[model samples]
Target: MPITARQLLQIFPNAGPVAGVFVPALNEAMARFKIEGRLRVASFLAQVGHESGQLRTVVENLNYSAEGLVKTWPNRFSRVSAAAVARKPEQIANIVYASRMGNGPAVTGDGWKYRGRGLIQVTGWVNYQACGSALGLDLLTKPELLEQPGYAALSAAWYWSKHGLNELSDAGHFLDIGSIINTGKTGTAPHGAAERKALYDRALQVLE
Candidate 1:
């Protein structure tokens, strides 16, 4: 009843231009993360499908400059800083300052760098570094590499293995995953609760 590689391929036939390559990598990561249960796998895949638009929009607005960089502070302001860091390095010349999202007037410092990536959409430099360390990758240097299917998949797996999907008890609470990935806000207003429940139901049907 579990979603097999074939079914996943069918579900996301057009998973970006590199579906052929990415799918295998995704499957491998899924297995490595032990995300085999039908419902759990479906839930995780569903989240990825929603976030990355089936891996088509990896760098959120096509901004892949800092694809693998981890954001220590992921506020809206930080997102502005991250954008600045990715663009005008001179503006925030110091790597330490730049890495910290800079104290520049242009940088928002509100924390938006924690957007989406991998299966769980791991966000923030701290998380990126943590995930990278877990997976043996240098996220600090090539944070944008998270856009790459191989690295993205591995990051997601690492997050799941560490956090455990059980933390996401309610299938309807997609924000839980979002929080895990984004680490921005808590579950104030539920978004994907019902839809997630429906998705879980569908997954259960397949399992049955």
Candidate 2:
């Protein structure tokens, strides 16, 4: 079932005009990915809502404080190291994300170039390549295109569909869905697990 702007707002009241703007794109993406059933739709919307910050921030914010850097990636950032790179979004991106997720070495700048974007944060070169291929977009050349509402919504729905979230949703194993997407410890909460669950509950109620 296609969600009305009113229903979306009910789930994400802080979205303001973004709810209406995303309705078409969201519906299109969901339909394309077969994100049907109340459970599936609610799970998709809830997770997307949290990740995108109520449809407001589609791009990943890499700005980190020294303490934040240490907390977010303890293995990568000692106090001294964190302080050195603190508040440097590009440098932080290059350092923490370096040599992983299909990114080149820190000096290569691929990490900063491919920092997370889109509603679901289609992160890294490998993911961008796959998602771009699926969506027929030239994301390698224009990575920022994921910030656009259409691609943002579509990419998120595509991720949800591809990752088997629909089955998790059907089972109402919402936290597992988050952990899987975050690719974090299974059965344990993912980052922002509480917020994700809260959003899921709100979406379930609103979608009903």
* Candidate 2 stretches greater than 4 Å from native: none
TM-score of each: 0.61, 0.96
lDDT of 1 by residue, 14-131 (tens): 5635666666777778787777665567667665655666657665442234432234324322555566656433332333333443222325431234334564566556777788
Candidate 2 lDDT, 61-152, residue by residue in tens: 99999999999899999999999989999999999889998989999998988999988998888999999999999998999999899999
Report each candidate's C-alpha RMSD, comma-separated, in the order given: 7.3, 1.2
TM-score of model 2 vs. true structure: 0.96
- Lowest lDDT sum, 10 consecutive residues, model 2, at 180-189
Top candidate on lDDT is 2
Q: What TM-score should be assigned to candidate 1?
A: 0.61
lDDT of each: 0.57, 0.91
